[model samples]
Target: MDELDAWFPYETYRPYQREMLELAATCARNGGIAMIDAPTGSGKSSIVSALLAERAGKKVIVAVRTISQLTTFIRELELVRSRKRTLAYSYLIGKRSLCPLSGGGDVYRRCEGVKAVSTSLMRERAGTGQLVPSRDPVIIRQMKKLDTQHPIICPYFIKSRVFTGGDGNALRMLPSTTLRNRADRITRERVLPHELREMGAGICPYEMLLLAAQKSDVVVVNYHHLFDDEIRTQLYGSLGIEPHEVHLLIDEAHNCGEVMQGVMNTAISGPALLQAEREILGLRRQLKQAVAVTQIIRNIGDFMEGLRNSHEAEDWFDPSIFDRIVVRGSLYRDLSEVVDDLMQISEHIREKNRAAGEYATTAVEVLTAFMVRLTCSAPDPAFLTVFRRDGDEIVLEVRNIDPSGRLQELARSHHCCILISGTLSPIESFRRYYFGELDVMTKTLPNIFPPSNRMVLCAGDITTAFSMRQNRENTDRIARYITTFASLAGNLAVYFPSYQILETYAGILEGRLSSRNLIVEPKDARDAGDLLKTFLSLPARGSSGILFAVCGGKWSEGLDYRGDLLAGAMVVGLPLAPFNRVRQMTIDYYRHKFGSDGEFISYTLPALNRAEQAIGRVLRAPEDRGMLVFGEKRFLEPRVRSGLPSWIRDEMAECSIDSFAAAVKKWK
Candidate 1:
């Protein structure tokens, strides 16, 4: 606390801020791991940054969950550097975020051919942080000098040259350039942003960041950069850093566990398979080697098409049919052989496209991934190897009902693994599910925000029990209940259990509320960030807007709505599992893993976590005040209350709609 007190930006620490720093200090001294759960407003990022900055002879790597979330970390580090005088870090962007040449305009489409030629090479070698010469820089330079504008050539040339064992400048430049820095400005030394890497450093930013990691105190990255082992290995290899020398600081760590499971999960869609068959067909004219592999994928596509046709005819596809086919001993070996063959011929197929054939490469990747998943050992006693149905597509996923084995492997390799988030309740349950017997410290800070500043109201009349989901009367009642608080003078959000509920109630809301005042999140909107941005920008009377989004989606977690912009949140239903085959398998796995507490681990806890996240979106700062209403009769029931968070369960008020509305008005 004394060391951080000098550098922290706030006038005073939140009650838990000093305590969290002390815990972090203890973990550092003992060389052990710690899991700390502080609410959203408790300044987790700041304290983590402060620890990294203040600690001596050690480096911290903070893996954030999203690129959009990276800004907060960077901004916090800047604050610490202003006074702490120990901020040495870099923003490491991925190919998706860093490679400007791979995206945008017609030059981007033309760049795709070179990208395909380079993709295979990138898969082979990590850059040595040195340049070799090729036409990539010249071509990119010409493209820039042409009738069109060019993206930064440094990043493109690095991959095209370095990947194939030849080289050019390895950094990409952008039109988002600025005047050159003065000698003092460049020499002053500060954290580097991805956009300015090429212009400021005159080196390949990606390679530069890796080299910089060896000398710097911290490397800030997104979760996928570490969650995926191959990518993680490339990072370690490039830096020559061992596991014991590095400590991981994971933000939004609850999602980190899910990300680990997702990494192991692989899927194949219908269009993707059909596209692979078409891409493979094009390879037939050039080489005879394509024939055997082409036949395998063709047969696979035919089988998939047959299933879809059967479903169209009978209204439902049988899970047993897919499961039986996937498990036959001979099937696994055949799929492995095909994957090997296809991987050999994939580059040739990609080359034939001539321009941008991302679709074809993507299709090949999908098939290879699913085939690879089929070959890997299943996690443990229970898991699914079957293809599941997702509206018009059959997704073949290697679902690991158990993720602890892989997570433990990662934890054991790192010097310290700290999983921090706002909603890591029942920390023991998280440890059981995510780490098995791995030794670690766990702590939770009491809610510093008072009951007077925030309120969680439970509805006594509404219930979204599975049995009543489809009933018109229930939907109508739920719709009416939302309008009660939504009509108030505040920016509000209503979260439903699923898109079906959101859409159904949204239609009912159409009659009561104007279309102009509603922002309904789609079940699978590609860009949710944009959707939220659009919602906040609309002309409102006084920061009083209304948005309806789904629980456990882009908006339900991670997003911070602080202040008057989001003054109230209404959660419509518990995020319950339907009586489906996958659900049954999940329950069976948990029952095997946790015995009696299995149900809570598998169902009740997950639902409450989502509900808790929704309620948390409103009260984001110390002075912030908001209303949180959980509008399901199940929420107020003894069985459900027994499992909820202490702050929520203890202060919740069960009230009639009229009385609740009056109280909210009075509080405002």
Candidate 2:
């Protein structure tokens, strides 16, 4: 206990940190899924750190949804290793991030399997029995030094890439265990800063990590390592790791189902189909198979024409749609073969252009992948085929209507799994949708904050319903409430259901709250950095700034607005997703299949998840006091209230502005 405590950054554990650590350790030893709901400031990372440092039973793989999270998780790993003397660990990311030299050249992308791992090389490594990598520090240092000045495009293991492509009797790096087994071997240790920088000089980061993981106790990676089939097969097979030998920890795990859905789902845009036709024309000039390629191009034009003539509407159907498309005799098989041929040729073209050192194969590769996905079989009944119309063509979206099947597979594959997040509630629906029949252990940690530090209230008179929103009287009432609330909190933010609502209400409130600056969120998420920077730079002590952002959009989640940057919120209207045809059909499908609870699962819970996320932004810490006003009357309804976080559901009440102001003043 003392040894593990030394690895923890904090002097002592937070409220639930100890319990979380114990639970995670038990999950590591046993086998099943553990569903945990701990709030934002619950020291979730600290618990995960302690688990890895102390529990050395099974190999640990920490998977998260995004790169930012992977970076953060690795930082914690660094701290644990600092205390434990040394821990071998690395982040396995997409090859593109680590390769700056693969562009504008014939230098094939690092860690490439597109060409093929030479079979002769694998047999050579096997015959020699020189499995353990032990190149000197001098050689590594020289490469790192060279890379710092001029990076090279070193596509390492051009031959080793095939060891696990389909064969299993290949090289297995000797089943190296944790630190206890490899304590004296420095070459087998974790890759440090300069070494990683050296790899960016063109070494295959994927293969490097596979060697490192052989000696590592904990390996951190993006969820793609587990969910994306191509990456999973390449990485696990190369590491010689079986599913049951590993334990998985998923942070921000609410999005686990979404990750699997992304791997399973694929979309073909209107423009890509047009481009594929053009690429076929180019192939006609290069290859003898011009006639066959020309036919596929003609079929694409016909398909586009059919979509243009049809009504512009969205429809959700089942797998039967695939059979109907097959009957049309569109070149499903030929399209697949054409993509493979084009890819092989593109490699050569890229090589020929190596001297010019430029790359333009991104679009071509993306189009080929989309075509390939269209032919995949979705045997799962939960996969829904959605068709939506665009101008000259239609976009076909394949979405997995449920995540239970994949979640069950993931659970069975690992020694055990831990799924934790701040908003993992409505446990019944989450379990039903994500875990299905698996027995999932669920736990919720109460928010650790002084009750008086935050206030939750709803406006009984003001309703942002479509019917009442534009009424002159209701507009004036809404404007009056926002202006008054703005005066109470110095630095605040307001959220809307859409950019349209943001524009509508901000204009209406401008006349009343002219002193406050209204900085709106950018329409595109990528363009939000400067807007947020300007907003965060404003004085946080007064009502001088009010950023208008749409709920569930650019500024809603993943932003840290503790203490000054955020003091209160005006979440205007329920973010009830419009009853679009697809949405209604989805609700109807669930209602017909599973009943009323299914309807709630399909519709109501998602809306509240966003609403809860919006409200949670104001109170970042125990000492930071803030206020929230729900502008929609529907928020006070029983169904909506049930979906909110327990802390809000327990304390929130309908109150007039006068009473709310007095409560905030006296709360201290």
> Using lDDT as the measure, which candidate wins?
1
Candidate 1 residue-wise lDDT, 1-668, digit = tens: 56657757667777888778777766765676788888777778765655563456667788887765677877777777687665566556664444344334334334444444444333333243322333245444544553223232234334223322335544532111212122123223554455444543433344444444555567777787788998788777766777677777888877766788888887777778778777667778776656666666655655576665443211223334543444343333445565677666765554444433232235776777776675654434444765556776765566766777878888778777787888888777777777766788888877888778887789887778878877877666677678877766667899988887788788878767773378888755787767788777653544456888888877888777866778789999887755566666777788877898787777777788888888788888888888889989888877678767678878999976677768667766
- Per-residue CA lDDT of model 2 for 1-668, tens digit only, reads 55446668766778887787667666765677787888878877665664565455667788876665666676677667666666666656655555433333223342242223222334354445433222323323433443322223222433123222224454643322332232223223444433554543333444455566666777777777778767777677766777777777888776777678888876666677666556556665666554464565456445545656556466664435444443345444534466566566555445543323343454345555554555454454566667777544577677766766777887778878888778777666777768766788877888888877777888877777888866988777777777777776456888888888888887777666667777778777677888788778776434358878888887887566877888888788888776667787778767876687877877777777777777778776778878887877788889877877788788888976566556556542
Best by TM-score: 1
Q: Go through the candidates in order and give the C-alpha RMSD of each one to the true structure.
A: 6.0, 6.5
Where does model 1 exceed 4 Å of error?
Answer: 1-11, 53-56, 102-214, 284-289, 309-334, 347-362, 378-382, 470-473, 524-531, 538-543
Clashing pairs in 1: 132-167, 132-168, 133-167, 152-173, 154-171, 154-172, 155-171, 155-172
Check candidate 2 and list the clashing pairs.
104-357, 104-358, 106-354, 490-542
TM-score of each: 0.82, 0.79
The residue ranges of model 2 lying beyond 4 angstroms of the native Cα positions read 1-11, 53-56, 66-68, 71-75, 78-83, 102-214, 285-313, 317-380, 389-393, 510-514, 539-544, 656-668
